[model samples]
Target: MRQGRDNGFQAPLWRAIAVYRIAALTYATILVVRNVAHYQRPVLAWPVVAVMLAWTVFTTYAYANPVRRRPPLLIADLLLTAAALAASVPVVGRQALEEGKPTLAVAWHVAPVLAWAVAGGRRAGITGALLMGATDLIVRAHRDQAALTGSVLMLLAAIAVGYLVRIAEVAQERLQRAIELEAATRERERLARDIHDSVLQVLALVKRRGAGLDGEAGELARLAGEQEAKLRSLVAARSVPADGDDGTDLMTLLSRQESPNVTISGPAEPVRLPPGTAREIAAAVAAALDNVERHCDPGTRVYILVEDAPDEVVVTVRDDGCGIETDRLSQAQAQGRLGVAQSIRGRIEDLGGTVAIVSAPGQGTEVEMTVTRLT
Candidate 1:
């Protein structure tokens, strides 16, 4: 998602620049009035002061909108500053220039540099400062120490302000990311609560009822019991934050579902997985167990095996219960009973994994789930 631009420093920086522009205009007007008698062309001086005042008012309005501070406007602003500096040579004459007297614009030239710094960071600031500084030196026709000193100060101000602007942008980006993460966490917690109140409770009841039954009904009850345990573990673990590293150990989480009727066997070492992939695989296993509990005998034996390969992880859930007929799944789907399709197959597919079910009418059922790490 695109983040909103950070304007945290905009108001204060522009406010200060507006004040500086007005003050500089006043300063320049006073200098012009004081030096009017010394000018070779006194008549031309008043018109230049009038132009400077008008431009200052226009820039103050233009710069208030960030979109107006683009390259074209910034370039024009610098050009205008240079023009004002050049006008001093004609209006104030060579005597004042040689004496290092402040030009008609005085501190007004800094407006362009400050604008560039706020809009384009260090590079643009340096460009604007250099343009103004070089123009001032050329108009003076000599390396006046005061002029050089002013140029150096302006350069330093541009660099510092530009650096601070960059820092603020990075801080704003991190703030946006933190906001997105908090929102996602809240949504996950809400979903977990809803699942607990409905799905988890239903599976627990099915497990309890099938405990003492015989034949396929007994096997179905046992399968329900295993699924109830697995789902509960998944829901509980999901409520807590997962490790930010590779992921939580898959074997450790799956082991939590082990019970008298459910045998879980895996490697002794930790089998790591990305947190999201691990949770989906665990949930798929729970759904497969739910299927067994609803269809197989209560005393049916179930085995869960975990294999950690170099590039992928594989989990297999097997049940020695009355097997599924060839058309059973099709019939279930047609009847709008989507427990197997949505809960098991749909989940694995969404994770870029594969689900393979092997079963027959009298034979046992085996579901193999595989997810690659690259996904």
Candidate 2:
């Protein structure tokens, strides 16, 4: 299954910021409309109001897309905010500026501070807040102690919000990583179960049968006994690290399935496969051997050849035993025996591979499994 990004908080956070911007714009508009007649140049102040309204709409739209909230737009936004604060001087008259009366921008000045906070964290937030606050002081000419306190509050708010956003982003990233690790763990456990049921059982059977045989068969049994130990160790050693992709040498996994009676041949170079895919293919091969052990003579020789082609990997398991009659499989299926159908064909088909069995009454049996590797 594909993992999803932890962006659950993103939409709500942006929406809250948008709502705050609109509310601040409304508050600024009310302040301007109420004090228009008191301004030294009402005409100049009216135009500034229009500009503020336009900027509010533009920033609201632009900030919705993360791409537009970067340095270029944020810097422009700060400039506009500073310009608005400066514009209030001539518009509100020298008497109002000296007395430190409320500017037309009012609460709307917080928008740029928020943008910087969201974009670049605490440092950017403090920088933006200080720039806008300094402009407010310059426009006022005489700083009221009340206005200074408000400026300090704005600075604190910017730092707090920026720090919180940074913390939230870090938490979200960790949550995503934990989710991926859990998925990988579950997949590995499932693979372990499947391997235990099919592959380990077949290896144990080979070891047991080979030990009781004589001469060449006994030597084959000794090899099978050694492989059984190696297979167990390999399975125990398999680990699903945090990265999710567990790399395994397909040849090494396949080679462990070898016994004296069943000879395995593959390339000298390691055939690397995704851990899950390699496990399934190996289990499918084991299922094929299980069928041979149950139906054929104990001494019947089997050959397992692995070919790592450019476009696909092919594995052929051939046994020199009495071949299967065409009706035997159907009869077995009808009687509720699905070893070949479910264990062999079903496993291969699930891995997006094909399994072809070439068998006739007097002829030996050969199961060819092919899995495509896309470039």
Candidate 3:
């Protein structure tokens, strides 16, 4: 995901440079026309015209081809601005010598201040101010009443404009980064919620059942508790796949199903299972616990175990509650109660697994589930 975003971020730099080149040239051409009359003398007008054209062409080419060529463009822009300002010196001198006071002819040379702000930023703005100030000083050297204060103010204004443009660019970049982080965080939270409601619910029941047993049942309960703890740790761990399809720990799914009120028992080691198989088994375990919670006494405990081998994984969920009567069990199923059939047995069936119930009068209930893992 990050690689794709980086590629997108870099894609526009070259294109933007290319467009800026055309825009800079167009701006230079308009400036030349507005000051055409002052350049009636071929020696003064032609040289300034040539320098302006060169500045426009060189800057355009440097910025257009490659976005990574920023250093070269920066150097070139600075050099071109210097050359253009140098050419203005002769024209400014001729205008000042002919006219008694400073005229608009010299003012025309300061128009490049806008270009400096657009292309080079704060440093360029400051450089442009210094260059403009020098030219103004040269033109006003012959006049007694020419003010230096106005030239200082103009330089300060150009520098301020450049800083503002640079600040706006920085703000835009920060805003884009903030948006991407927010999106990634939201996706992580959504997946966490799904895991909590489904797989985690089943593990809680198993842990509860494990806490109430004795002897082998007690050992099974201890194993389930371990599995429950592992699942909780995995969920809290940052190593989980960002996308749920990357993979999921089967034992972790079962562990997440645990609850304080429900005792559980399960396998000692994690039983590797595919995502589909694990999802079904986890869902079945949850439905079984839901039955225990809803139909059995509040104090009932459950036991869970996982038997995994080369071809299949099996899960057993048992509850120490009043055993289901044969007639009542049948009646519960007939009255549109699909909790066990659809939520438990049906899910395992979809994953090529089998579910069986073992119970009799005066005895607790047990559910055995087997899912064949396809290599």
Report every candidate's CA lDDT: 0.80, 0.80, 0.63
Clash number for each model: 11, 1, 23
The candidate with the higher TM-score, 1 or 2, is: 1
Candidate 2 collision pairs: 220-260
Tens-place lDDT digits, model 1, residues 1-375: 011232666667777888898998898888778878888778998888888888989988887776676667778888888888889888778877787766777788888888788778888788888888888778776786777998899999999888887888777766866777688778767877998898888878888888889999987877777677767665555333344345767776676566656788888777888787788888888888888878887667789999999988899999999999998888999999999898988988998889899999888899999887884
State which candidate, 1 or 3, has the greater TM-score: 1
Would you list the rank order by TM-score, best first? 1, 2, 3
Residue ranges of candidate 1 with Cα displaced over 4 Å: 1-8, 211-375
Comparison by lDDT, 2 against 3, better one: 2
TM-score of each: 0.61, 0.59, 0.44
Model 3 residue runs over 4 Å out of place are 1-41, 64-69, 91-124, 139-154, 215-375
TM-score of predicted model 1? 0.61
Better of 1 and 3 by lDDT: 1
